[model samples]
Target: MENDAETEKEKKNKNNKVIVGSIICTLLVIYLGMATYFRTHFYFGTEINCVNVSAKTIKEAAKQMTSQMESYKLSLKEKSGKTEQITSTEINLKLSSNDEFKRLKDKQGSFNWIFGALDSKNSKLKANIIYSNKLLQEKINNLSCLDSKNIIEPKNPSFKYSSTGYVVLNEVNGNKIDKDVLYKNIVNALSTGTTTLNLDSTNCYLKPKYTVKSKKTSEIKNILNKYVSSKIIYTFGDKKEVIDGSKINKWLNVDDNYEVVFDNSILTKYMRKLFSNYETIGKTRNFVTTSGNTISIGGGDYGWDINSSEDIQKLIDDIKNGRTVTREPIYLQTAASHSSDDIGNTYVEIDMVNQHLWFYKKGSLVTQGDVVTGNMSLNTSTPAGVYRLKYKERNATLKGEGYASPVNFWMPFNGGIGIHDASWRSSFGGNIYLTSGSHGCVNAPYYLAQTLYNNIDAGTPVVCYY
Candidate 1:
């Protein structure tokens, strides 16, 4: 009976030992499984709750974190609701083992503790992104538009960029820029967020090439008035009376009653002084009455008489010594003929074929005289053409006439042929036959020769017909 009882006790002890061993084995398996899951799933330094999060989800959280960095680079930020979306997925996985739980406890206390910590870090990062993006947007909004006020008008107004200096578009006239159009374009471009614009440099610019205040019309008008009043008019020939109002008006191209405005600048001060103190002998009058009697002095229809004869003489002297008005150089025709208006109507004409020269005044013959020709042997034939009596001298000597005497006058006819007072030869008619007859000169009587020499100028036409 004692042996059977001991064997029953040993069997009971073996069954109890087997049951304890199975319980310990099951706990060890659970611990190993949880440790493996934490090791494979959690990021290092993450909270315990993050341990059981999938690796794929962790990678997605890293990607979302990188977005903040990207936003900073682009000068932008995520919208307000976007922060919540990022944090919900990144903060909510459960802890699965004591190792993961210990990591969270040491670093962040617990799963609930880790969740709040991560949410706080992410919230701060999102706020920074938002602030940075707002600042960038404000800067872009405040950027100034390139309008007319800011656009630089280069010196001399050129369409091209010059490294050394500005080039002129139109040096003679002026420069014209459309400021209104330029301003409008700049404003439009800025409103639409455009980067650059095209400008035209080819427009012609005026003399004063620069940008000025737009409302300076009065200053511009003053400058123009000064320029216009500086002009002066001059006339040639004898001072004749401007008889008719219409004639004076047509000549001046102004109204008949308009006042003549003269420049009183330093350039004309001396001229004004001279005219104020002197008396003019020949009047340049602008007629105002119908009888052609009323006259005026200077440029107006008002008269000022001379104080004395001495004043008249002084005026004449001033005119003679004053600087002559010069005109712009003009090229004249090269033809040898003279106009009828140039030479006076009262003049003389010499006819070599008839062997006589005649002086005429207003178609009436005043004087006539006999003439001679040159000898054929010496090749001193009288030339046949139109010529003018150039110059003369008294008490002249005749070298080809074979004798030296006090001749009264010397008249060179054509190519050294001259008529002079032949005092040495006392014979007349039949060529006079005096020493080879003559050398192309026409010997005339003394009195007629003296009168002809004193009356002609260089431009007088001497027609010689064979």
Candidate 2:
């Protein structure tokens, strides 16, 4: 009987322990379920835009954010260090649940909410916003700091050439009404559910059209300085004309996009001035002979002609490269050098009226004699004006019109007409060619033709005139 009672007491003690443990586990499960339920709503401490939304559902949190919108304010700071405020009623702001709230709500879980509540951290949601742009602009424009008289016009930045180089003029950010950007600020603040829109921190203001800090400004300045700092000089004998930066600077221009534009009219006017001052082609000249005789001569392809098209490009290049040189101008038809008379005293002068010839060398008469000209009565007369010596030959046959004559020296200056030795003619000049002329040649003495041929070379000027 004693053994049965001990066994029964042990069984009773074991059953009581099992019952106490079962009660403890049941109470703990109830506590955990309640904590998870509360956490599923919102953590112990949660804030959305500084509004307490702890343990609240998505609809409840949205309701809390909406209530704060009515009393919201926007603080705008001006360039003059003045602060401006706008009431929520002015802009008609409305609070709305943004993606931030949805994301926070999606992250709430039974297991994760436990650790979040243990951390005792404050979680805040952004205030997504909406507002009327027109109302925002009206309220901003009505501010005391933004009055009509107080408003200043914004000026775009510019670049001007100085003595040193191209300099940038700072953009003038005048006190102007920036209703456009201020209206955007209202929308931004409403979207993010921000109670206070700070203009100073957000950089929301009226801005100038251009700024010196722009990359295009530097690009334009580089091009302007390249043209403005260049130098070019054109030389005319001892006189020279300089195209300096002051003149070139006038040709430079910057468009709205900061692109460089050179005014070709300025270059045209300058080139016109040069043409009027120094051009000498087609101008009448007073010709003086080697024998000290003066005659007026003009109207021929016998003077310097400026190559306007080619030289203009070269001049522009030299100016861009800053070249300073003293040399003769480029010419199309060059005549020795640009001076009083292109044909100097060192040339062969044939006086058809006097029927005389003079060979001048270095302003001194080297040879002088008479020469038979073409038969004028027969209409076979030698053409007048300036020409160049074509070539010279020795022991050449002169063939023309049933006549095959041979000469010791042949110096042709004009077409088939030339200076040659004629053994058939006994006397020269005095209209020897009037009836019995030797074609259109100047029949000099046998010795004179050889002497003249040996002295002058090709390209020597031969002035034939009456």
The best candidate by TM-score is: 2
Off by over 4 Å in 2: 1-213, 246-282, 290-292, 305-308, 331-338, 378-380, 390-426, 432-443
Q: Give residue 79's lDDT in candidate 1 (0 to 100).
A: 19
lDDT (10s digit) by residue, model 2, range 1-466: 9999999999999999999999999977986875667554677566776677878877777666666777777666667778778777887777644566656766655445556645433355655666676887677668875688887777667887789888999988877756666667756666655556656456565677668888777877777777776777777666777777888888767766557766777776777668546665445567775457887655434455677667767767766665655545677655554567666666788887677788877778777788888888787777676666778999999999888999999988778988888888888878776776656777888777877887887766677777
Q: How close is every model to the real structure, measured as TM-score?
A: 0.31, 0.49
- Which parts of model 1 have CA positions greater than 4 angstroms off? 1-208, 211-345, 361-364, 374-391, 399-406, 412-417, 423-440, 451-466
